[model samples]
Target: MAQETDAPQAPPSAPTAPARALLPLILPAVVVGVTASLVFVGVSVAAERLQQVLWGPLPDALGVGRYSVLWMFAMLTATGLAVGLVVWKAPGHAGADPATFGLNSPVMAPAVVPGLVLATGLMLAGGPSLGPENPVIAVNVGLAAWLGARLLPRTPGALWPVLAESATIGALFGTPVAAALVISEALAGRPMRGRLWDNVFAPLAAGACGAMTTTLVAHPAFDLGLPPMSHHPHAKDLLTALVISSAAALLGMGAVHAFPYVHAAFRRLRHPMLMIPAGGVVLGALGALGGRLTLFKGLSEVGELARRPEGWSAGQFAAMAVVKLTALLVAASCGFRGGRIFPAVFIGTAVGLCAHALVPAVHPAVGVATGVLGMLLAITRQAWVSLFTAAVLVASPSVLALLCIASLPAWLLVTGRAQMQLREDGTPVR
Candidate 1:
């Protein structure tokens, strides 16, 4: 017997293009981008100066070696106290709980600005394994949205947060492309009527402008001056990189799984004054164990680690990674306002260096890049950003191929795992 014929399927509809942003939209985007860059750079410079004083002549004059474990302990403990005070006194409790704030959170109120700035600066100058990215982004988004509302009262409210976040990210990485990748990932698979690139337009424009402004004000280097990569990585090198990177990814995953518990424990105290300082004491002890090089947000230290990978023994590198990871867990869980991306980069560098120390045959550039790739992918769960950061930091064409291949195994290790965020009510924020 003949089977019933299946009905013919209708042709798929062509995708609709997003409407172009008019002059009014572009104007506010430009304004927001410039303002965000200035605010971010200003905070960064102020924090740098404070760090120089705290870790420099101040320590020297006090007859304490800057690298002393005891000094790190004292400074970190003091930092915790200062941040606690800022959070306690600042308006709006510094704009929502940081534990609940992911990379893409709502715009904070302007009232939250002072406390965020103070706490972020303290984290930077103190010995926390956190960076200013999160707090700075919050400040810029809040301030920018307020400014945008004033300038273009009739504009869509959604545009402001996107523009502000894109601008801050651009200023942060010194590149518009990084912002695009990050935003694109966040927006992926969401139900939207327009083409993805169309949705990307305004943010891209803001990011480009922000990157330009940041470059003019401060020429920060993402590349850490790693040695030239040798000839194309060998097969064995790729395999070794996969192994090393996977290990690092697993290490970060361990922290991710523990994040919620640690954050909840800290929250049990229910007061920033009690919670923050106690976290600080734990961080100080970790800093003491890891040494001063393991302190801070770790951008500059990553360069140092990359520049002289040979100077560190395998045991030393392991110690650095363990201590820094511990410090990151404490600082983030204890309510310090900062980003984990930069510190994760440092941890990845330590992991990479340790691999190199243990296995002499692994290329330094390959080892370092893959390790960074793994940690970033695991911590942020952003593959493109992780790849971009790793490639830019090394600036070596030869290692890129190996890093790309190594990332697959690393991704497998991290996929479907708990995210490194703390949510209220004991629910994990993935």
Candidate 2:
């Protein structure tokens, strides 16, 4: 009684149980990594190879100019609508958008993951403009959450799944450390830090898995000559880079603003499922309208751009840019899930083509780099990220210099505009 009455000793001042209760992170992270390796790389490679074999011959048969935005639009469009329908009609449902990256919403609805993946397969098959990265990320996150809830041992040992998430994220990004950071930031609300060992290996496993898988099935995710790294810049070139990069940023910011409102307009559909799938299919068909402007995944096209920076006629490039932008917009709003990264590349390439034609002083390579820089600016709202991505893409210090120089003015133009805010996840906020 005396001991109890002494303010109950304040219950020993309380142990302060973990803010997050993730305990089983040790083995799960490894599993997540291994699974991602098998699933992601396997899916991407199988899809890519099939696409090549089936559609690869079409361009040659048609004597196409190289690639077509029209074809891309049609395929992605169909994919979007199909995905929308699957999500709507399917029993399990997960939702996606830029918000998925933020984890600001509930982990996916569980039912939707299957539909999204299936739709992604459709998109890949149809030659749409969607990227697997976004869907894969969603799938990864969803799996982590579901497993964390179900499999982890009860009695205060939920830490392992959290670690698995970190590792999986890190592996997927091709940067184990970054994946860790990404997982940390994403799980900040979840309180998952006490078990370090459990989480550390998750990313390692996932990274190894993703890397091996990528090598087995697909070409390089990113490749630029090391020699390009040696290129230096004159003051003038630096200035150009600055201007171009800035312009790219501003453009990106503006796009963030515009895409949402347009999407909103499309959102009021009484039958979003039907609308999205129909929209996707229509867009795919629309892509076909541009004649040879349609094709599936532009990886080969990107290679073509690199190979013959000087070869593409200015007019053809311009057409490609317009069609690509339209295709991406339609694909996204219509319900297909994918990142806009590669599409942005196409846009930038177009901008580069146009810029070189208009400003003959600018090298085509520099111009392409500038376009990519600007689009990243639009997407990330982070100048530094844009700069880094752009610089890395060209791998030419000289070109990067020019793009950085261009980025300033672009920032100036883009920042003040209402269109640049992303919802704090570095995605377009609007």
Candidate 3:
């Protein structure tokens, strides 16, 4: 649940480098980008394969429905034990108790990468309501920094983390624009020597290559396949967008407020062995209530929800939203190694669907997009990513203006609120 950022520090003095000097970094950036994408895709494929084994053949052979309440409970509990063993026994403890560190935390040692990767793969495969972004970024950052230092001793030590972070982000989202936006947000208010684009140059190239690599290999898609809003923006639609986005933001803030309390409860269990399996049990129960639609990191599930919105009632969507939010809280609290963004998206999609079902006038695309915008803004506290994600989910140019406007009020509600991350002492990250 740690929020991601570009971990490396910017230079203290504002001294612009010559364009030619930066040219040397481009090749390395390209390499880093492609490497990051391969790592991301590799881990994802491995996790998916494991997931198939756990949720597919094994269940069939056992003569139990893979997603039945009993099977869900058993599988999730077992997953927790497996990951708990890795965390308790593995080196670096899966890289600093995922709850305590953000993506911008200091680069980890290369020695810790294997354990982190294993734990991440397990969580992703095990159906935890978390995403691969955080630990994956940690893995890449550690590897990139350690390897980059050896290969390019003459380069600034800070450059590797930036490149790795940007590249992995591009791979994750299947677009360099996401990487560019994330890096640009990090650069804001920092003392930098060069023009903004100059500073962004190498990372941008890395992001582009990373995005291309993932697109070529995996063909990830973010659009939820909702029917496009055919009419021009109306005054009522704008008001509806604001209302839904603000409500969703407030809803997400509820989870943020509850994060520390839930995390503390797990901490009181005092061992990963106890805490994680206990979490899995709770997650299983929630999944039983919410069904399979509310499980996992939520990208594909959200797509499914959008594809057949009429199949579920408003109450069903509401229940899914609540259950997913709770599941996200418990999973992140109980020492699971993953990110919050994807689950938050699922929660948002559910909320949006609920709104559309209830009111009928709220366009599905508008409801879903603004719902995501608000939830992401509250959870990630990153404006650009929130806007980008919400916009991308609907994939409508017409919705962009509405999302941008809706985000303004939603951002206000979450701006000074406690973020959905915890400090070592279990306090919310301010």
The global C-alpha lDDT for each of the candidates, from Candidate 1 onward, is 0.85, 0.57, 0.90
Cα shift from native, residue 391, model 3 (Å)? 0.8
Highest TM-score: which candidate?
3
Tens digit of per-residue lDDT, candidate 3, span 14-51: 56779788899998899999999999999999999998
lDDT of 1 at 88: 89
Clashing pairs in 3: none
Q: How big is the RMSD of model 1?
A: 2.6
- Tens digits of per-residue lDDT, candidate 1, 1-430, equal 9899789989776476634544456777688788889998998899999999998999899999886877888898888889898898999877677777767767777778888888888788887889888888888888888877887788888889999999998999999999899889878857765677777878888998899999999987888887876577777887988898899899999888888889889989889998999999999888878887888999998888887889989999999998898889889899898998899999998998899899887777777888889998888888888999898988899888888888999999988777887566766656
Whole-model alpha-carbon lDDT for candidate 1? 0.85
- Report each candidate's C-alpha RMSD, comma-separated, in the order given: 2.6, 7.8, 7.5
Model 2 over residues 1-430: C-alpha lDDT tens digits?
A: 4454435444333233353433333356566666665566665666776667445686557665324664455445545665676667665543554322421223575677777677666666666665665666666666666765677545233443344444444444444544544444444546454454343344555555554544554445444332252346666556656666566555555556666665655555646576576666656665665444334445456656666666666786767766666666666665565656556766676667566777777766677777787776666444554555566566565565476567767766666455422343333443
TM-score, per-candidate, Cα-based:
0.94, 0.72, 0.95
Candidate 3 local accuracy as lDDT? Answer: 0.90
Candidate 2: RMSD over Cα atoms? 7.8
Question: Is 1 or 2 the stronger prediction by TM-score?
Answer: 1
